[model samples]
Structure formats: structure tokens, C-alpha cells
Target: MAESHIDLGVVTAPSGVLVLGMASWIDHWPQLGGTLSERARASASIGGGHVHDWMCEMVAVRAAGDRPLTVRAGTAKSPLDGGPTIATLEIDLGIPWVRTAGNEPIILGDLPVDRCGMVLGDALALDSWTGDGHPSTDGLADVTYWGAHAEAAHRQFGGELIPGRGNQVRGWLDLPLDDAKSLGDALGDWTGDEQGRGVMVAVDEHNDFHSFNRASRTHPLLIGAIEVADCPVLGINWDSGDHSMRHRGERPFGQVYPVTLQPDRTGRTTMRWTIPPYAPGHDGPE
Candidate 1:
């Protein structure tokens, strides 16, 4: 086992939510034991590589707002290295936003009581695992550590975890190049009073939509949406196999409306958009 670390840079968002990207490059894939080996064997049997190990992308700490919130990632057992893969909201040290990656991205932190985030495109990358090898034990070991950390954080900052919403919709939007670009630009601009109604849309290399979510602050904010666009069409390809939820199955020419972030009388910001329905040939999720 080897130890390594990479500084993922800093965040400084006043909105109290941050989205960070995690990427990994394994120098060598290690042989393993326990459940990791079993999973690795299964993956290899079906032409999979490095599907059982987890990667830590960004660690968030609650400290002074003026203090730089430096994000970093490291491997405890394997010699791995990666950097923050995307640009996102600055961290408002007042709130904690940490994320870990396995096959899918998992967010951990506290969010404003009234704010919500959404996920679009494939919210979870069930088959795309980063890193070179399997862990020595069942993946639960990492979970145990994270669980304890969560408990400690809870005790320090009292809050109960609440379940957010999840929905699976099957359809795609075919926007003109300009509209597509505008949508893409709006997705990156996080400045505004809109405290809630943040949407994370995931797409493929071909700019085909695959996942969508109205997520909570507890989940990674919105950076993942941009990263997913660069990914291969994992939802429909063999890489995802039968595990991916077919969220975006139809491609229809759709109009893109301007995304508006308006502040209400109470000074709270909210994002508003009227997403068009699937084209005539396609239907939304039942």
C-alpha cells in the first residue's frame, strides 16, 4: 500500500453550496482479497477493469469564510493521484460540502433548510469506476470510516438527514447550437440569489442528455453535470451494462428557454425554467 495526495484547489461561494470534481489515475492496479477481489473477478470476467475501488475527490471543512477552503484528494492504500476535474461554486466555509467517488459520486454536507438542487442526466455512474485496482476488503471499510465521520460531524453540528426526491425520466432535448451553448453557459454561472432550484443535467460526449436531478445541498452541487457531458455514452453502452437507469432514451428536437434567477421579495433567489415536454414521438416517465 502507498499514500499519495493532490490539492484540489479552493472554493469561495457565498451561497453555501459547492460542487467539486474527482478524477483518478492509477499507476498500478493492485491484486486484492475479500469482497474487492470477488467484485474485481466478476468485472474482469465481463471485460471490466478497475471497477471496485473508490476515489476521494474533495474534502470540505467548515471554517472561517475568509479562510481559504482548500480541497484535496488522496489515496490511503493505493498510489493514486488526481485533481479537481471541474470548476464549480466557491465554498462558503459556513457550510460543509464534501464528496467521494466510487462508481457514482456521493455528496456529504449540510445545506440551507430551504434550498434544493436537482440532478439531470445520469445522476449515478454505476459502472464507471476510477482507479487501478480493487480494495483489500469489502468496500464497507471506507463506508465505515465515512459513517463515523458523519456521526462526528452531526454531533458537532446538529441536523437530521432528510430524504430528497428521485425520479427517472426518459427523453432528450435537441437544442439548436446557440441554445445549447446558452444552456451550457447558464449551468456554469452560479452567481445569483437563487438559493434553491439548482438542476444538475448530465449528458454524453455527443451532447445527448441522459440524467437529470433536482438535488439537495447534501448532494454534490452541479459540477458533475458538466463533467458528465464529456463522458462516453455510458448509459447505453456495454460499460454500463444493464445497471444504468434508462433515464434519457429518446432524442427529440426541443426548445431551450432562458434560465432565470430571480430574487423574491424575501430576498431569496430561485431558478425558474419551463422545460418543454418530450417531442410528439416520446413520452415522459410514467
Candidate 2:
């Protein structure tokens, strides 16, 4: 049988349901090589403010009313690279069901009023904006700092699945670098579990201010392996340095060898990700 595929773009149902994923226009795309104020103003512009540029592991859907939902495992290609399948998930949304057969089924209505954020027959929505005023990125160019903020937002807004919530967790973790040697030692000591989990280590590389931003002296470097189980789409900036995704085991998965920035390219750097061939245990593209 042919494999199924889900449209990663914005999806809506006739029942007043709206679904927004990473591909949806949620936030403004940051411009490359400009003053913080200039960048902010450019982002606020209509054409500049919103773009489908984020690459993520998870897919978020907003459902409405008491209508049931159906989710199926399928392959989605990254619009950034247009290369290979990124990730697949299998889930079904329907009448309340129990995972185990023996345990007494819990009643949905019996749940506490405060806990039942999404009551039946109510519309569901997700607002990406936190409503907090944008912070100054003036002297800050560290990707880790931004990643930390993203993680914090996810936690503060009650996780990614909560309806009407503003934040979605991207699973960004920080690896403290104790010293110069620690960087090498950490890479050499990476474990199989980490590889299977598809963790990427980002290193800062120096670059010209024109290439990126005045505050940022270096481009972002990403290293490690990627798989369908991990973040399917690995986001990258246009001026980002060379990145490597190496697999340890015999089996092959999504891996980007080395993607370097091209100085000739002009305008804002478009968010991008390299797609690899679909691996075992993942659904192939239709």
C-alpha cells in the first residue's frame, strides 16, 4: 500500500478548527547583517515579519468543539531543502479511550474544572506570541541563550499540547562547556543513547559582521546525528557555518554532511534544513 502524507502547512477544518505547525507563519524572520533596531523594524514589516522558516520535530494541531480527530503516521518533507522525509508520527484522536484494559477507565467529565482546560464543545487555539514585549537582542548573539529562552517559554505556558497556550516546546537543551578540552572530550564521549536521541552540539564560529549581525562574531555550528525519532527538521540560518550529522551504527538515517554559508547570497537568510532519505521504522514519502 502507498504510504500516507500529512500537509505540513496550515490546516483548517469546516468545524471552525485551525491547525498550525512549524511551517505556518508564526513569527517574524530575523534579517541578516543589520543593527538590532533595523532588524526589529524589518521583522515587523508585513512581508518581513512572518515566514515559514522553522524546522522542528513535533507537529501541533488545534481542534475545535466535540468533534473527534484522526491522526496518522506519515512522511513530511522539509520545505527548506526539499530533499528527503523528516519525521512521522501515529496517533488517533477520538472518543476517550484507555491504554490499559484492566484499569478502570477514568471519566473525562469527572476531572477538576481547573484541569479541564479543553472542555468538550469548546474551540481550541494556540497563540505563539507570549504577549510579552520583545526583548532587546542588542548585544546578544548566543544561540544557546535564545534556545534557553525558547525552552523557558515552553515550560511557562504549560507545555505544547495545552489548548489556547502560547508556547510550544522545541526540546532545546544546553550543554555547559567547562573549558576548551571539555568540548573535545564531550564529543569523543558521546554515547549511543545520545546518538539515538539525535542530539546536536552547536559551536560558535567567528564570522564577518556583514555575514550575520554586528554583535555576533561567529556563525552557528551544529554537530551530531539526526533521526526520525529525534527532531526531524534541524533549523539553520543562511550564514551558519559548516554542520555535520554523522551516524555511528551501520543503519543510515537523516544526516547532513556539511552545509557552509555562501558569501555571495544576499538578503535575509532563509531558515533551512537538510532532508535525508527515509530510514527504517519511518514512513516513506508517497
Candidate 3:
């Protein structure tokens, strides 16, 4: 018997969905050269913000209907990280995909969705880009959505079983960075000590979700790692500096593509999914 895989799913235009781990601001660490309050202030002004790849387990969706579904989630926060890691969150599905289950599962929804996947958790988007802060190569805040926060780019598409098991949640969102130069400047001396560090959000054709490193607009997806002990709050701690997924000498995951975002004079930015439509390309037996 072969493992089952499904199409991840997509979010059209401004609205989107994500089953992300806890996310947080990148510059919240002093070793990384910034403070939580400083990053918070910058996040309030600049468009460039970074967050930890994705850690905990969270679902974020943006759509019509304003309501919070009651749930008994984890209230305990990570000793290392400040935010609550395990919690029952009210997941308001803007687009309900399946029927509720019998037992109260950690995640609720129909079982074994043949062609579609289940959506859990509510949507949380924090829009605070004033576009008034000065743009720098380094020291910029990352975008935050829902209570989970934000992550950046990289792309993948396919329609086969993702080679893993169990239910997987996936979705997409857009973010603005400090261009390649500013990003490069922030990287400074890349001795793996303090190289280009950031967070990103991505979903593949298999509906496999990923919150990986946010590479520079100019840097290649080279393999690297950073010590992430000081910043324990999963929501604000952006860089885990963990590259264990890739083997030694292995290239960074996912195919790097150019994302064209249009920012009107008003400073509001918009990006549409192009090649390989934003939705998952699931080609499994239906």
C-alpha cells in the first residue's frame, strides 16, 4: 500500500489560510542585534518584517464571517518561548471544507478527505505597515498575521502523495522585505554566526505546508543554522537556525521564484499567484 497525499489548497487574492506553527518577530533577539520592543516599534512602521520559520501548531485563515469558534486549547506557554504553544483555538473556517467529526479531536473536521484537506483554527491577521519608517538593509520587522505572526517565500508544485502521512494543513500569504541590499546588509559577516536570518511561509502542490528561512532577495538558498535559545517565544522568535531537514551539502529546499507585488501609491501592496496556480496540484486517486 502506498502512502496517501492530498492537494494542499490555495487562497485567492488578499484573503488566505495557513496551518502555521507559532510565529514571531525576527529582531526580537539581542544577539541578532535587536530587542523585542524595538522590533515591535519597527514592525509598526516599516514594511520589512521577519519571523521564525514555523514551530508550534497553528491555523490562520482570512475570509468573510466574523466569529470565533469556541475550543479548549493549550494555555501553557513555552518556557523557552513566551507564547502559548499548545492551546485549543477557535478555528473559524471562512471556507468550511468538511463536516465536524464525532469525537473531540485535537483538530476537528471530516475524516480522510479524498480530494480536499481539513481546515482548523480561526484567522488572525495583523496589518500594521505604515510605510513611514525608513527602509534599511538590516534591522526591519517582519509581517504578523492572526496571533501566529509572519513568514516569507520560496515555491513548490506537484500533484502526488507528499511521501508523508497523517493530516496536513496548508495555505499562502504575502510579505514585503527590505529589498536585496538591505537584506544583504543585515546578513553582515556570514560566519553562520549572524548571517541573513528571516522567516517565510510556503505551501506546495502536495498541500505540504512549510515555514522556512527567509533568504535575501539576492542570496542563494544556502544551508545554514543559528542558535535560537535567547528568544523562546515561538510567535516572535523568527529564526530557529535549524537546517537539519537538509543534509550536509544539500541545497536549500523549494524552488526560488520571482514574486511580483504591486504597491499602489497608497502604500498598500497586492500579489496574485501566477504560474502553478496558488492552489495545490494534487493528482492522487480520487
Candidate 4:
């Protein structure tokens, strides 16, 4: 009997032999069962592709699945800007359990199943999370990753990102047109996934915290209130009202660098930090 149709985003093409996450090229890619290829014609744009579409290339024929049906794929651009290369890939199906991601239809290739246990980041993503209404697999990263990519692409190519927040906390940071290269480089590693994953940054006057979470793109920090500085940085002790349960999302204890011409790498960067629900010290300082 034909398997129940699973919406693979756009159309329900028969559940292909593989399921993959679509993204720009990464220098470090995963390896597949069969030979990999670049320059795909109908490559699926599942996660995010606008950012690297020009700088990075595309791929297909990565039907490579593992005994456990694990797969990984990525691409990267060359200095010449000739095209992005499919790189940094690996898939080990040694896991005892083998099942599709919630039985939802995924790409034929592009699995995250790792034999030696999932990576720290992957483990966090794969873990079941329900602090709020967000499930671990509910595209939390997808929201963060593609959201930023789309914002960047729209600003660079189409124009300033839409759904603006008056002052534009999430739009293009007054970067020189030539700085597109630098911008892309700085944001290349940014991803949308923010599940069990967490990071702590020191807070300081010279720093300005920015929530890449597109949900808070219009956040007062990004939008800037009258009292707040133009670029918002997470301070050790910030205004409770400002930091209060933003959309019920967990706030990062660390701060991001200030939006200054020169980054103050001195004592004003990230200070102390921690990921919540997993308090560092049982009864340590709050």
C-alpha cells in the first residue's frame, strides 16, 4: 500500500528514498553512500538557500542513505566565486534505532543520524524540548537559520528586509556595499536552531546584544526604545521589564558585541553566561 502522503513543504512528491536539509555550502560536509554531485537543477530549498545561492553552489543525486538511513550534505564557495563545492559530509547508521523524523516526509538524502552519537549541536536539536510551546524538532533552528538568511538576502539583493520594525534592528547593519563579503563571512556560521543548544557571553558597556531570533527581530532591543541604546547588548543586570519573558522565549544570559565601527574586545564584551533549565551550579549565584 502507498505510504500516507507527507507534506514535504511545497508538494508531496512520493516519499523519496532520502530526506535532506537544504542550506548553503559548508566547507565541512557529510559523506554519502554514492558519489556526490554539484550544480543541481531542482535542488530542494528546504531550510535556507538565499544567502549562499550566489556565492555557494547546489547539489542533487545525494540519495546516499545509511543502514540507519543517516545522511549529511553541504556546499561552500571558492575564492574565485566560480561556484560552491559540496564538502564536509558524513553519515553513520550504527544507531540501534532507525525511524524517520516523526514519520514526517523528509528529503531522500541529508540525514543527521550519526553512528558515534549525535554531535553536541545535533544532540540538542534531536532532544525533546518543551520549555515553551516549541518542540525540539519544531524547526527552531530552521526559524533562526533561514530567517536570518532571508533577512540578509532581502536586504542585500531585494532591498531592506520586509516586516520592518520602524528603526530596523534586524535589517542590514549600515554596511558598505563592499562589505557584503564581510557580512556573509560574519554570518556564515549563524544558524536558526536554538533548542537545547546554548552559549554564554560576557556583558560589558561596549557590547550590544542582538537576538538573531527572527521572532524578536522587532524586539525593543533591536527596535531600540528611547532609554535603550541604539544597538542592544545583553548586560549582566538589565531592565527586568525589557528582559522579561520575551514572547515566552528563553533569553540568552550572554551578550553579543556592540554594533560599533570598532568592536570593543576589551572588558566590555560578554561577561558571565549560562543556558537556562540546566542551571550550572545547583544553588550558585543567580
Rank the candidate models, highest TM-score first: 2, 3, 1, 4
Per-residue alpha-carbon lDDT of candidate 1 for residues 119-217, written as tens digits (9 for 90 to 100): 211112212333223331112111001131334333433223332221222112343445444444443342223453322332222211222221111
Q: Quantify how close model 4 is to the true structure by its C-alpha RMSD in Å.
A: 23.0
The local distance difference test score of model 4 is 0.23
Give the top-scoring candidate (lDDT): 1
TM-score of 3: 0.20
Cα distance off (Å), candidate 1, residue 258: 40
User: Deviation in angstroms for 1 in model 4?
Assistant: 27
Score each candidate by Cα lDDT: 0.25, 0.24, 0.23, 0.23
Provide backbone clash counts, one per model. 26, 2, 28, 36
lDDT of 3 by residue, 1-286 (tens): 1112211222221223222222232221334554333433343233212222222112222223333222112233223334232212222233333222531122211111101111221122212111112242223333311111111211121112111111231222232343323333332222221444433222221101111222211112111111122110111111122111111111122311122223223432322111121122221212
Select the stronger candidate by lDDT from 1 and 4. 1
Residues 188-277, model 4: lDDT tens digits:
443424542221111111111122222223442221111111211111112223223211122123311111011112311110111122
Q: Of the pair 2 and 4, which is ahead by TM-score?
A: 2
